[model samples]
Target: MFREQLARDAARIQNQFDLVLGGLDDLDVTQAMAYTTQGGKRLRGFLVLESARLHDVAEDQAIWPATGIEALHAYSLVHDDLPCMDDDDLRRGKPTIHMKWDQATAVLAGDALQTLAFELCTRPEVGVAEVRAGLALTLAQASGAQGMVLGQALDIAAESAAEPLNLDEITRLQAGKTGALIEWSACAGARLAQADTTPLRQYAQALGLAFQIADDILDVEGDAQKAGKRLQKDADAGKATFVSLLGLDAAKLRAADLIEQGCAALETYGSRADTLKEAARFVIARDS
Candidate 1:
């Protein structure tokens, strides 16, 4: 039942994204856009919609806000696949945006998507003016120089450094790189629903940490075919990861603990938060 619901929700968001992209026609831009947006589990958008539902917001009413989060996620994926970053050629079982098109086109496509995310958030039909503005600001801060960008910088630096970081340093790196966006997704959902943010923020924090830990676990054990990119990239790059620093079993245990905390954070919301709780479970259990 949960998987079916998730699939339906994903289709709805994909349709919304298609509608949003209908206004653009430049071949290169559209190609780059399609390459990045075409696939993925759409977990971030699901969180947005589900969190909103938990707070009594209708799914239709939440579509634009959810799309905004997905756009930011797509933008990040495009840049992360660039030669300067992960140097990945494949994503979602197909060529990455940078690989499908020229690097410059991919860069511009990412930039456009990032800007479009804010545009979608600020659209009058989707949210109130203040909510839109606040969501836009939150996304920018999460994706900007002080957040994900800074994390990427540290990751690149760590890859080249003579001394490798220990577990604490690696956790900090993953928190910024992966955790920032996950936190943003949850926070954006709660904000859009007009829910009290204190507990939501706590849930987002724990969920983000759990998500990264699971990602690291997948990197260690998942097949490249399933992952849609090279497995063990962290090991190849000599970057510190949870599995690399704490070992596989310990990392798995930590992920479980984080997921528990994440679900616990939402306890005050009761069964209305079942979707978010299930989402936290999915984060740890996902193979991709």
Candidate 2:
């Protein structure tokens, strides 16, 4: 049910983005924008919307701001797939921006998208300047050197190390690499609604961890066609993962436990949190 809702929301947002991109010139730029914006779970946007709804913010009030988060996410994916990072050739069952076009085009496109993300945040339709400022700060902190970039550096560093990682080290790496942006998505929504952020932050932290645990499991057991990316890459890279640290069964159990904790963190919001609660379950249960 949550996945269906997310898909619907994604489709709506994709249409909006298409409309926004219609005026762009350069073919490479247009291609890169359209390619990266294609099919995603849109979980980040959903988090933003659901977090806003928890505070009684209307959907219309949430959409434009949520689009900002989604734009940032797409920008990250483009850069992450570049030759310097994962060097991934494919994403979401489609050619990566770098692969579809060229590295130069990909780099510039990613740069443009990053700026566009901030533009969306500061748009006149995005409500007050104070809220926009808070959201933009959250996004920068999550996406920049202090957060996801640092995490990616750790991941790269771990790959070159001869020694295996301990659980704490792995946790630190994943928290920055994957968890930070996920946390930002939820936090941004809470900020937009001017809601108390303590519980939202806690829930996002747990959700991010659970999401990574599930990703680790999927790396080992997921179908390549469904996942839209290379499977068993973690094992091949000898990268430390939850399943590598703990056995697959234990990792699965840990994911479930984290999801429960995530749900518990939002208990005060009651049914307003149903989408987020279901999203937690979906993260672990997803085949892709």
Say which candidate scores most in lDDT. Answer: 2
> Distance (Å) between predicted and true CA of 31, model 1?
2.4
Tens digits of per-residue lDDT for model 1, 1-288: 457767887899889888989778958987678667877888888777777777777676688878878888899888888898788888888888777778998899999889888888888876677778888888788878878888788888887789998877877877788788778777766787666777777888888888888888898899888878788887877777888888899989988998888889888988878878887888889888
Number of clashes recorded per candidate: 0, 0
Q: Stretches of candidate 2 above 4 Å error?
A: none
lDDT of 2 by residue, 40-135 (tens): 888888888778777777777677767777888888889899989888998999989888889998888888888888888877777788888887
lDDT of each: 0.82, 0.85
Q: 98 in model 2: Cα distance from truth in Å? A: 1.7
Q: In model 1, which residue pairs have backbone atoms overlapping below 3 Å? A: none
Root-mean-square deviation (CA) per prediction: 1.4, 1.3
Question: What lDDT does candidate 1 reach at residue 168?
Answer: 79
Task: Specify the poorest-scoring 10-residue window by lDDT in model 2.
Answer: 56-65
lDDT score at residue 67, model 2, on the 0-100 scale: 76
RMSD in angstroms between candidate 2 and the native structure over all alpha carbons: 1.3
